[model samples]
Target: MVSYITSTQTLSFARKPHPKEEVCGDDGAAWDDPDHTWLVISDGLGHGAGAAKATEAALSWITANYSNNLEATVRGCDKAIRHTRGVSLNIARINRSTKATDYVSVGANLGWKVQRSGIQRFAGDSGVVGSGVRNLKTTRVDLDGAGYLVLASDGLNTTSDVSALYHSTFDGDVSLAEACLERWTTGKDDSSIFVYRFT
Candidate 1:
């Protein structure tokens, strides 16, 4: 078996709802197989029960079929949740051997990579997954060496301060991801951030 040194962290918070509400509006999953690592973030439509249902359906498909190609995996998820409210999701895959990263988005959540060279941003197109995507794009990037990758839900502002991610020592600190999650929280809705440090 081949091994790559990689660390992952995820931060998720629920949206405040009416007194009777008891569910979070967003969900995410991250995992690594022998060959591939995946990061997924989903926001259900709206901010309560309906949204939670949509995300559950979407995540079920994502978890089961993530081994497939990025486009096909997303299409499968879309079909699986068509009966529900629908969701906005961002999916990312990293090939452990090649250090190649492929990501696709069908909603408002987005992804970014911080590398010694520069930062690469991946933004979503307009559409709700499980409903229909009028426009969308798949992005591919190669990790040169050690780098940090972040995928965030719409609750967090994309333009907020990210200087911490640029510091060279960020990757060395074990708490790097936790500090980032705190710095990026928008506090307005159900928010989440998935961090991957690949070496």
Candidate 2:
């Protein structure tokens, strides 16, 4: 588990590997620039060393070359891990000043926005990174002050209601992520959850 706190937001990430595997195949990261905060989640094709390598490559590339252009960032990640096993990837950029969020996703990743009104789901385009992507597009939404943003790998069930979970397990971001992992993980794959709270 890892956590990041800023004046405008708080981010927490939690991950677990398959019971039989020594390394986790899912990877996540959150970072802040002067004007924006970037959040990413990557799940490799399968569990083990090969899977870990693929996600690591994707994260490394994003860390080094990320820009405001989300589509270009996804394309760059695809090319960066072309030699390794493919991965499902999601990237979200939040404008610090405006609280507007831009999101891009591919393959089986999941995203949701939890607000006082309701939970809004963001579905990914169908394609594995490092293979090929089709009909790629970015989703933009206003976080609108105080709310929660959740991103998870397919290893966790996406069908559950995230806002209810937030209300039921209303701890800090770290506890929320752990609760999601414990309650929804498939137990057959590497699972990961990222929770971001912005005010």
Quick one: best TM-score, which candidate? 2
lDDT of 1 by residue, 73-164 (tens): 88778878999999989988888789888888888896888776778787667789899666666788887687778787776778855545
RMSD of 1: 4.9
Could you tell me which residue pairs clash in candidate 1?
none
Writing each residue's lDDT as its tens digit, candidate 2 over 58-132 gives 888888898888998898888878998899999889898898999999999999998888889997799999987
Estimated TM-score per prediction? 0.82, 0.92
Q: CA lDDT of 45 in candidate 1? A: 84
- Single out the weakest 10-residue window by summed lDDT for candidate 2: 1-10
What Cα-based lDDT does every candidate model obtain? 0.72, 0.84
Runs in model 2 deviating more than 4 A are: 1-9, 170-174
